[model samples]
Target: MSTATVNPAGGTSPAPAADACCTPSQGEAILNAGQAEALALRFKALGDPNRLRILSIVSASESAETCVCDLPEPLGLKQPTVSHHLKILVEAGILHREKRGVWAYYSVVPGALESLGASLAAKP
Candidate 1:
């Protein structure tokens, strides 16, 4: 598995430092078009207010994880809609999902949630 590390936020993310010769070794290169697009897509998914709220809630959850059934009451959305958003988050790599019998669980993917912060710090 590719390890994604949750970095503490610095004043400026690495994206702004694309040409930075002083780039930290922790920063990974977006060496190809595929990587750039993938990172952009992840950011786009998080661009939504609802998804952002969901991420915040899930991130702050006691277990750092939650199930679909547990989300609606706090989010004030129907389960189906919540599930749809969850799917988008999962696809975008911001959230991790797993099946436990009939229900599905979601959790933030460590560094995955913070990729945008890194991208923003880059030169691009």
Candidate 2:
């Protein structure tokens, strides 16, 4: 019988089977083409350090919303540059934009981050 070997490091480890290593079972894809494309865009939007900082600021707001006007000061970026990053995030569906009079407020989309985490989970 085939069996796993113990490493003596206090954790159970499964045996590595060469035959099973590269074999793919007949199963549905982890992500469909469209879902992959959408997830890719969201990840791409997050690829930039500036965009990640912008998301962090909006996420930490007291009211769960922050005005675009308030972003530039903390980031030390100009309004136009901040707006450009916000636009990518909004297009990626990671944030919600609400225009209030002259300023635009941004908030994290409900369960957006959780959904993204779930998508990349190790187990379905």
Candidate 3:
């Protein structure tokens, strides 16, 4: 009752059993749809070069926060454009926005980067 096939070389080999060939690998847990969508939004926010630069500038500021006013000159971008990038970062939960007087200050959200990295880490 062997399930074997003849090869072109005139050799008879046992074909792979259906169950063995179709078995799924036991891998680590994967992200759910909601988690995937949220992480995708965060990654999408960081995908732009200008947005990444804005994050670096804000995170590297001496006061641990940066005013939107100061970002335009350093990035060589217009004020409105800088503000737009900041808005996306904030919406992605990667940055925090605070209003002081008429100015908006931006800072990296605590542990946000670490959380994003951990989501992609392999479980042991």
- Full ranking by lDDT: 2, 3, 1
Model 2 TM-score, all chains together? 0.71
Best by TM-score: 3
Per-residue lDDT tens digits for candidate 1, residues 6-113, read: 246764333434444454565455467887787778878888888888888888884756888888998889988998899899898888998889878788888874
Which residue ranges in model 2 land beyond 4 Å of their true spot? 1-32, 62-64, 122-124
State the local distance difference test value for candidate 3.
0.80
Steric overlap count per candidate: 11, 0, 0
Q: What is the lDDT of residue 57 in candidate 3?
A: 86
Models sorted by TM-score, best on top? 3, 2, 1
Q: What is the lDDT of candidate 2?
A: 0.81
lDDT of 2 at 115: 87
Worst 10 residues of 1 by lDDT: 11-20
What value does the lDDT take at residue 35 in candidate 1? 72
TM-score of 1: 0.66
Q: Once model 1 is optimally superposed onto the true structure by TM-score, how far is the C-alpha of residue 110 displaced, in angstroms?
A: 1.7
Q: Kindly list the per-residue Cα lDDT of model 3 for residues 1-27, writing each as its tens digit.
A: 454433457433445455434423335
lDDT of 2 by residue, 1-124 (tens): 3643434575444554554444333456667788778778988998999899998888888376899888899899999999899999989899999998987889999888888888779543
